[model samples]
Target chain A: MDSITHAPSTEVLRAIVEAAADGVVLCDADGAVVLVNGAAREMVPGDVTSLLDRGREPGETYETTLGDRRLRVRREIFGIVHQAWYLRDVTQESARADALRAERERTQFLVEAGRRLSASLNTRRCARATAELATGLLADAAMVVLPPGGLRRTAWLRSSEAGLEEGEIPVAHADQVPGLAEALAGFPPVPSRWLDPHQAPEWLLPAGFGPVGHLLVTPLPGNGVPAGALVLARREGGAGFDDETETLVRVFAARAGAAISAAVLYQEQSATNTILAGDLRPPPLPVVDGLELAGSLRAAQQTALIGGDFYDVLPTPDGPLVTLGDVCGKGPRAAVLAGQVRHSLRALLLLERDPEQLMHLINKALLSSYTPRSHVTLVLAAIRPGDGVIDLAVAGHPAPLLLRADGVVEEVDARGTLLGAIRSGAITLRTASVDLAPGDLLLLYSDGITEAFGGPTGREMYGSVRLMTALATCAGMPATAVVERLEQLNSDWLAGGVFDDRALLAIRRSR
Target chain B: MDTAPFLIEIENPEPGTTRLTLSGDFDYTTSADLATMTPTLMSRGLSVLEVDLTGVTFIDSSGLATLIHLYDAAEEHPAEMRFVGMTPYIVHLFEVTALDQVFNLPTSAA
Candidate 1:
């Protein structure tokens, strides 16, 4: 102790304390402020002793809010009789953490919105998801006004604590809510502050809902068309829609709009397809005396139901003119061409009943068609009821099979150029006369029957020989039974594999 | 069923003559490739266009349409389009559609 030379005095300690960045205060054992640093005086200003907790144990730390500023205070034993209090301003740090929390919440909400909105291709369901997602986070209540589907009314879905509700409002009623009419018309949203909440119509809110404090209206833009609009409401006691919340709403609306519009487009396309397919479906065969008729058609594209192959039995005074044809290509385009051919055949048949003459007329019609490559393979059979004679003319089509009562099948010897093919417009026909004996069946089919790509190896064709053999097995059966049996056998040969459009028609002479 | 991949090989064996050798399944899905190549195949000075279908395993209605389209374009070009090679299956298809009467097929195919 005697060897120590320079010991710092209280003045040096006071100077060092005054120069420190943190606010420091010293208190005597009597619990009164004995010394205060420059930083402590600036922080506390008027009452430095009031900021300290004299009862706190030494080295204990605590946080306190002074006015708008946040102070972190720690108490420590200075010497034996004095206590030191350290204070730090942490106001900006806490505010930054709060902003980070808000940012995370916004990101989470968007992720959840995307998940819910993309789950449905139905317009109403998508609208419902949009309204539900906007509630709680964006507003106390949210409403989605769907685009006007009819002239008189538009649908609306609302979500709140009371649960989801749906209703229709008159198209003109959109104007009752401020900015709603413009938003529904696909205009940009009117800022919430610009619109008065008192102008909101009663129908926009649920029953027993409190007075609206704020209202936000935004348009849902779609692919070149307006999808709908979104309406948000906060009750009188709730927080008003701020800038950040409004921006979030705009982003959410954009996604919801795209999903709803896509669903609308899909619905329209499928409806049109259904109507076209319905028109191209095979017609029921007309009953011809002394003859049984049956037919079946299966398209390669199962969803379309209509294909390139078609058959119709047209009634005539002389007899029934049965036609089976395969148009080039497949699906809606081919089905449309097939429909055109059928209509042309009907128009041509009104003037000409002779199978060969009809073939020439159809060939002329097809060759003159604006659609290129509109070729068709067809077989026309004119049945003579009294004598069981059928005049058959084959045009670029497979020969009709003769299923004799004795279980013998023969391919009719007939050939002709495909109609509408050969830009030269020349088609030669070698028509044949077939005498259908009692219980004899005549079968006309498209090439799809023979070209099916399934068997034991899953790549072998069903082939004409297999078809002939199969036909021979159903020699004496009724026409319907014969057609059904042949189809069942072919489907089995395919074994659930992919296939082209197959068509089969049968004409039988009953005993 | 898995279909064979379609391929088209073009060659100029002689002046003013183009030979297209087609292989694999030439059906609805793949016939567009040939149809799209029609303009290029029917270029000016194409005096003779020879098609070889010996390597082709299958042909459908769409494929048949494309061939007819090519033939029509050739006829319009005042050029001769002929089938230089074919399988028995294609020969039967030609005979059925009576395209054999219009298209100039090799003697073996006939």
Candidate 2:
């Protein structure tokens, strides 16, 4: 190898510069272009000097746009009196980076959409969230048209520069917006390109919004039916909805649809339950000529507000028939059975005045019913207001406690088989009679009162002994005050813990 | 209220006799277990069915209904169903519901 070498000639240097893949420009100290490579001439097409910043320091780089292409330029000192500028086309590289950023934004938007949409079970709130989330990123303005619930009108929510607005549109108005009716009917959405933005009705957009440039309508599919539809719009000259945005709208519509439909179903079920529970609630105690009566009932399932414990006072020509019963089980199932038992007692009271005979009739009625395991524990009391005598019959229930005027609590001596429990169809009941003097009260309570699992330890039961003790304190109080005080004490014993259904009814002889 | 886990153990103390030992809460939520075990309890050659409830801590109206249902099934099978073991709490419940008269409970357990 020869060690001695000299610099290449001008022609060779020029040839090497011309062969480079990057554009090369050489400028003299006075800023006049001295040489231009073939690549540099192709990159600018015109004067390349205009693309370079004269004030830029050597070794500094900058990017600039030349027509449709992006170019990155680097300035460097080439020799004692010359500066070199290198330029490379970066259009495709920047485009790829922009695409990646947009994809990430779309993913992040969907994640936010899922979290916001799933936080509510209310229909209006969910629709509002869907519309608010779609603005800024997905469109300039967004609207959500809820599924038609009533026959005449449907609800709508809109979000735009004016903020959120809600209104109800006539059901027939759905046909005015292109593709809206089809989308609401659970049909596949038409592509945004297929829709004419000019055809959007005035009602479909917010007030003062300019001419629409792009429109997209997508159906919100539900469990088995259509939940609702989404409407997106962009102002005139704004970016049109592309294929990626359309796909994102479909995914967002799916989540919104499930949330909306679930909310709708829940509202309907709760409304129905409310009606049924209203019927099962305890009735007002009738006013007896010589007696004062008070009753209170609480359900174990607080949401349902109906449970197995129930009490009713029915009036007859002779006196009022007071009935308290607890059907087997809890919640809605038990509530239905308790209602049946109450209705049966009312019907049977018209035929038989004796408490024992009513018990027998209810037993036979329940045993022959189609529902299995329909056991009921009931107490029927027939009062003779003239003589202040109460005829009591207890069947598979806790006996009523007699509170004398002097604070002596005695359990009424009555025992019987549970109504509808035995398959033999034969029930034995030992009925008893008790006289109520003035100021004396008779208290009938469900086992929930005595069997309450609450105390200082949080696990102990509020047993009968405790109940009798509590009753002793309320001997001289009014019937209403007595029930209220007892309930308060029991609730305090629970100490925020769970409890079962409790029913209490008090009868006081006033004269 | 927290409930104890319910458990049922089946054993054959002698020929033609099936003993079911039940422990824990015997309320509405757990009564279905006994009702489902009824068909299996009434096998061929079943002369007697014995229920041991000494380990039972709680019994609700639904639990009583399940027991009554079991008794009805046993009667239909022409077999004698007896309460072999019982806590005083159960005995008191049985007496209150008048089931003590209907069911074949042990005299000593009463």
Q: Could you give candidate 2's per-residue lDDT for residues A63-123 as a string of tens digits?
A: 9999999999999999899999999999999999999999999999999999999999898
Model 2 chain A: ten consecutive residues of lowest lDDT: A298-307
Q: Which stretches of candidate 1 lie over 4 Å from their true place?
A: A1-104, A149-153, A168-191, A194-196, A302-306
Candidate 1 structure quality by residue, lDDT tens digits, B3-99: 9999999999999999999999999889999999999888758999999999898998889999999999999997999999999999998888888
Write candidate 1's Cα lDDT for A307-375 as tens digits. 688899988778889999999886677878988989988888888999999999899888888988898
Error of 2 at B68 (Å): 2.9
- Per prediction, fnat is 0.77, 0.81
Give the per-residue Cα lDDT of candidate 2 at B79. 95
Q: How many residue pairs of model 2 clash at the backbone?
A: 0
TM-score of each: 0.83, 0.87
Which pairs of residues have clashing backbones in candidate 1? none
Q: Provide i-RMS per model in Å.
A: 0.8, 1.1
